[model samples]
Target: MQKFPFDAIGFDLDGTLLDTFRDLGAAVNHALVLGGFAEVSVETSKDLIGGGAKIMLARAVDAQGGLPADEFKQLYKAMLTYYSAHNAIHTVPYPGVREALVDLANKGVRMAVVTNKFEGFARDVLSQLDLIGAFETVIGGDSMGKGEDGQFLAKPHPAPVIAAREATGNGHMAFIGDSTYDVRAARGAGVPVVAAAYGYCDMPPHELGADVVIDSFPELIPALEAIGSAS
Candidate 1:
């Protein structure tokens, strides 16, 4: 077995490991239509991603016209209901993701998924895609529970990423993701992060302030290796 750089690695789910925009967009559209808003192109969901499903739908809806809180809550519920059943419809591992994962596993690297999605939803989607077993744990936005502000203590908060490292039983950890949320989380946790440029990045990948940036999953190992070597 090849020795790896880090003892544990965490990944962001939606865009980093899988292309889930289509299904996410579909859910948003379902909610929007039910709320009497014009449906948006599924492709537009890519721009609304990174913050989670609720935020994704809210962004799309807010684009048309902001909804009343109670009404938006009901629409959000409807979207979750629709998404739970169809989360994997058009979702698939990004190109080279599986191969890269296999390679990492072969190197005996412990891995976890830290996503802004709800824990149950993340697990369900991963399970449906036959990718759940690859992770030692899946830490989601809801996993850390609602904060005093009534918001999820998720990425950009550092709690989930820290939880992932603990769950994976690794002190030396690294994170890979596509969004500023991921970058911020890793930074706040003081862990090295690699940006996935091919994912649904909320900002320019180069602007994410990652320790390294990779254009494809296949580049992950090398990027990690480089980080390791430099350290």
Candidate 2:
């Protein structure tokens, strides 16, 4: 067979490679109850995932009359604590993810994960799932360090995506994700992007402006092949 299209691939963790809504939702509820707030339906976690844990809890709390800043800070901390231990309980690879990943590796494609989750948590969860070994590197939302604005240099910034590409050997690359954050980051990094429509997309798949849209993880290699052919 002819060589594959790209030299490397970068992936987004939650909602893209893994179905983490249930575990993430549980963590959010754990914090909500501690703050004396009503627990949100776990399914609601799908809508709040792309932004990361702090934002996930913030949205859930804000929906119920909101909370004082200091109180909310404490609750966010609580959520993190709870998530650290329970993140992998219900989290698992999406359908065909394993086979696709192995196929890519067999094709000599380097792989890395660029996620909005904190570094430690991302590593821990991936480790628990035994999936960490598949990636050349894992770049978390906090991995790039804070910028002058006192915020993490993460997705929507392109820094992490750029870093992932560089880490994976800096050749032709493509990014796969389910959210606008992923699309924007991949575009900013000047690579073709494939949107994962089956994941918890923050917007309609086509509207996300990816170079291609695929309905499931199994479709990835063909999508990348198409991207390669066009490029």
- List lDDT for all candidates, in order: 0.92, 0.93
lDDT of 1 by residue, 117-215 (tens): 999999998999888999999999899998899999998999999999999895689999999999999999989999999999999999999999999
Cα RMSDs, all models? 1.1, 0.7
For residue 178, model 2's alpha carbon misses the true position, in angstroms, by 0.5
**Candidate that would win on lDDT:** 2
* TM-score winner: 2
Candidate 2 local lDDT, 14-109, one digit each (tens): 999999999999999999999999888898779878868888888999989999899999999999999988989999999999999999999999
Worst 10 residues of 2 by lDDT: 44-53
Q: What are the runs in model 1 whose C-alpha is more than 4 Å off?
A: none
Q: What is the lDDT of residue 116 in candidate 2?
A: 93
